[model samples]
Target: MKTQNQITVTQIETIEQFESLREEWNALLFQCVEKDVFLTWEWQFAWWKNIGQWEYQLWILLFHEDEQLIGIAPLMMSQKRKFRFHFRWLENIGNPECDVSTIISIEPQKTISALLRYLQEKRQEWDGLELMEVNATTTGNQEILKTLEDSHYGFWRTKEEHFYIPLMGNTWEEYYNQLSKNMKHNLKRRMKRIAEMGTVSFKKYSGNSLTWQDFQTMCKVSEKSNFPDLYKSDNLLSFHKDLLEFMRELGWVQIEMLFIDERPIAFQYGFLFDNKYEDWRGGIDKEFETLAPGKLLMVFSLEERFKLGLRESDFLRGVYSYKTDWNPLSREFTNIQVYNTSNIKSKLAYWWVKHLKPIVESLLSKEKQKEQQNDSS
Candidate 1:
């Protein structure tokens, strides 16, 4: 680590460098105020190896205090041409994929200052930054955003919310009884419908116990569910396969299947890490849609987690009545896009993201709506 001032900044730009920092990376993770399962080394490494490397360049940064690691910003940069405009921008490793993200730092101000100053100096390499899934509750990120606001080089967009249920050793029955009346009624009615069809059962595989066949079975059902986009691509499918293998060895993999009459009906897949269960992805068979097998699986999964005394149940990203019905708390995520003052390209890119693109998209959406109404009429 090279030191110019009190806080020294070093960057990890190679896969080999990332591979070597596994232990140190996780050790710093525990010190973060906004600790998240998605922010772990395993998740970032898996994403970078399988999907990100092909699309983005690694730009992960490390902030040090006289030889001791203080903070890390897991970032990547990508370039693209859209509508004849050539642009390059930086973003967090898990954009549109992983749910929650934040800098791994014990000293919020010191760490953030070093990182931003470093980025400010190297601004010529990238046009702008678009950080996603940053937890609003974390002070480290708040400091970073404050610095940006004061510097006049960045803008913070509208916040996005992610939901999680605080388990805290609560009994499953106690928690279930507290759900909204309508949710309880609906869940029970659907469950009864499922029970009438045949005997119901659930099977879970985790860590070394999870097999490729089990994951593929879940994938088959998920493809027919509401989230077909999650698996419709070969690259995305391969990404999950790779993630499954990497996570399984560390006892982080958690995939649970619900069955009726010995036929699989739903799959609830996620990770069990840091004593919290991250509910990442799930799907139910289209044939069992009428029975709402997904809700049943959610119920089973939550109950099982409570039984294990997990601290929290993260529903990940998205807002749905089904998740809301469980009475989970919402965590808002704020994103920022900052540009280099000296670079004209960076200013234009920032302007496009912060102003022009939204107006154009809104106009296009309204036009599409009008066309759809005409077709329907």
Candidate 2:
């Protein structure tokens, strides 16, 4: 273990170093009380194995206090062509399958300060650090951003609405009562109707007993039901397969399958890590839409998660109205993009796009409206 006085930041270049740092890194992250699956080694390593080759470089920043690991920042370096010079950027390595990205550790305040200091000193070697898709609502992230601001790093925010349903020690009756009257009525009606169809049941499976066929079936239902475009991409399919395999190996995969008369009608793919169950994906058999299998699946999944002793169940990133029936506390995530101040041309281009794109889109929308009106006349 290295003390703060003798702290060293080394680029993680070999698989051995990455594996060796895993225990310490995870220890620090869990100590912070963060509950996202993206921070898990199962998720990150699967991402690295599947997609890290696409990036220019990958680096893991480790901080130690008296020879004990205190914090870590898993980053990937990439180069993008700018107007003058090629700009290098460091970001939380992410892919389509992942939901959120940010620096993860227990002591974010201290770790972020050190990270900013290192980046400022090495500014000559690169353009700037770009922390993308951070959950701005998280207290630790707000502190990290404050540290960056104090260090003279320019940052901007783009808002994102994440959907979730909270479950802690509340009974199902209490949860349902909190919903709006109309929503409550609708949900109760849906569940009752589904129950009338046949024996409706929900089962959650994790651990090594789960089979690959179960995973493939869930993927197939997802593609056949909501957003076929997601599975259309070869990269996304490969990433999903690798992630499932990795999670299964680590016993982090939490699957909820809703059945009517023992026939699977809906399923949810969630990851149980860091004491939280993140609902990563869901699919329903359109044939069973009238039975409201989707809602049944979610309700059952929530109960199942609670039974497993999980703290929170996140619906991840969509704001569909149906999710509100569970009465979750809404939170906003943000996207932060930073550019090098030294590159004036790149700055100008970025400003133009940022400030002018909305106006251009609005004008085009009006023009289309006028054309539609003229054709009607």
Candidate 3:
């Protein structure tokens, strides 16, 4: 490896460059002390191939020293509207199932300064820079934000609360006992009621081990449980299939199926990454709502995570009351927009959107209400 001061930044220009650097990129990414699966090449490439579809341009920046790869920032530029200037954004290309998306690398101490310098030098080429949906708890984010602030990049707030649960300890029983008495009682009561009806069982399988029938059943059940209309979208189904296959290849896929008397009732699809298990998707048979199969599946999955010696259980992006009952702390995230002063019009538009947009919307809403009242009278 080369010394820190000898590092060079190169923009990945083609798919060939990306492919050539895949192994080294992933190695450095995984070496980070608190890296998440979202930063994995499998996840990133899958997003580019499956979802990006030439609509966006990728501008990955690599930091290398003496022929040793150390850092990367996966960035994309996309046009929102004709009148609105294009924005350059950086993220992990995370799905709803993943948490904490941003520009991350193995050695922040060495690479962060180089990254900021590069962005600062290229400020005139891009309208703005956005790092969206970053997990506030991670030091990677704190360091990056501080560097950007010191570099005089524009900053704005987006969101303040994200929820996740911890899965620490040796056994499920011990972990469950940590919950409030009321939560424990409720979970037990639900399990007992479901058990009284028929023999209930749970199975965890991976994409490689799972048959095609298993995937079909999960899709069907999820469609029936969540949104039937959404299930019919061909792109969505294809995306799910690709995600499952990719996760399975990385040995991170986990499919938990719940059954009653040998009939499938509920199922969950999640991933195990960086010593943490994320509950990404799930579906339950609405007909079995009385049995609370969804709750049973979650309880079983939590236990299984503990059995595997994982450190955390993330419910992903959503905020639901049921998740809080498990005693996990909620974290806040930010959506940042940074721009250069050289692009005056673009900068003005961004400022209007960030600061004055809410006030404009509120006033418009009030005007609409008064007009409606006058017409009615």
Candidate 4:
């Protein structure tokens, strides 16, 4: 056992360097209290390979207590120009892609103290740090925030909504029964309609069962979905291809497809990690619109997870209002963009963003509303 002060920090800035930490990275994640699929080495690496590499450079910080890895910062850096000012900033990997990211540590306070000290020590390297999609509900993350506050790192946060269904030992039957009468009726009706078309079945791919062909088939279905443009970009498709290939190798890919006889209509792609099912992306064939394949598959997927002994179904972050129908509990993720307190310009920018910007926006919005009212008259 190593004391907190003895914990050593190292920086990993190259892909080759990152590849070496896979086993250790995941092992440390397994020991964390707030483990999620998004924080996995594969997910972060995949996101960086496809998205971050074009602009951002890796700045991952790893903390070790003599040879045993204890915590990971999972951060990256990019030189950015905004509002006509050039500056550098660091952020957690998997931005906009992962639902949330948090500090991976067994000891939150000790790890955060070490992390903050390191950041301040190297303040010249970055003018700010934007830690995105941090799960505010977890006590560990709360501790991280508190440590930053105590350290006097001037920080403010914005929030995003996350929704999930807590299955924590509840049977599918109980969950189904708990749905509102209208929802239950709609689900049954949709299921029955799809059943009438042909034999309804479910296909799941994970571990060794996943294949690129099967994954492409799902993408084809999404291409014709109500969210047709979701996979319209070759770049986005390429990212998923790389991400899925990496995640599948680790037995983390959890894909559930709803089929009618020989035809696939709806599919859900996500990771089943640490006993939770994250519903990353799912879509239905618009050809099956009348059958409501989207809703049918959603309920089926939930039940399938129940059978798999999964604990929660995270609907994740986005504007999917339909998730409310599942009676999912909700949480908020805090996105903190902290300035480098040592830099006067950075501190001023942070204060302006935290204070004056909102008021300015509010006034602009009111003027716009007044103009709209005059135009209507």
- Expressed as tens digits, the lDDT of each residue in 84-142 for candidate 3 is 55544443343333455667666666677887678667776676666666776778777
For every candidate structure, what is the RMSD over all alpha carbons to the true structure, in angstroms? 3.0, 3.7, 4.1, 2.8
Residue-wise C-alpha lDDT for candidate 2, range 1-377, written one tens digit per residue: 22245555555765567656656666666676554678777677767766675665776777765566666778777776755667777777674446877777667776776776666556665565666557887788888777776655445567777776666777666766777897657667988888888988877778776776777767667766867565666666676677777678677887788887877888888777767787877888888777567877776776666666676777777778667667788778876665555556446645654687679999999999999999999
- Ranked by TM-score, the better of candidates 2 and 3 is 3
Worst 10 residues of 2 by lDDT: 1-10
Error of 4 at 368 (Å): 5.8
Pairs with backbone N, CA or C atoms under 3 Å apart (clashes), candidate 3 = none
At residue 210, give the lDDT of candidate 1. 95
**Model 1, TM vs. native:** 0.89
Which candidate gets the maximum lDDT versus the true structure?
4
Candidate 4, residues 32-127: lDDT per residue as tens digits?
Answer: 888988898888887787777887889998888777678999998888776677879888887767787888998888788888878877888788
Q: How would you order the candidates by TM-score, starting with the best?
A: 4, 1, 3, 2
**Selected candidate, larger TM-score, 3 vs 4:** 4
Instruction: Give all candidates' CA lDDT scores.
Output: 0.82, 0.71, 0.72, 0.84
Best by TM-score: 4
* Over 4 Å off, model 1: 1-4, 232-234, 352-377
Q: Write the per-residue lDDT of candidate 1 for residues 218-317, one digit (tens) a residue.
A: 8778877877667767777777787787788888879999998778889988889888899888888898898888889988888989999999999877
**Model 3: how far is 290 from its true place, Å?**
4.1
Steric clashes per prediction: 0, 3, 0, 0
Question: Ten-residue segment with the worst summed lDDT in candidate 1?
Answer: 80-89
- Candidate 3 global lDDT: 0.72
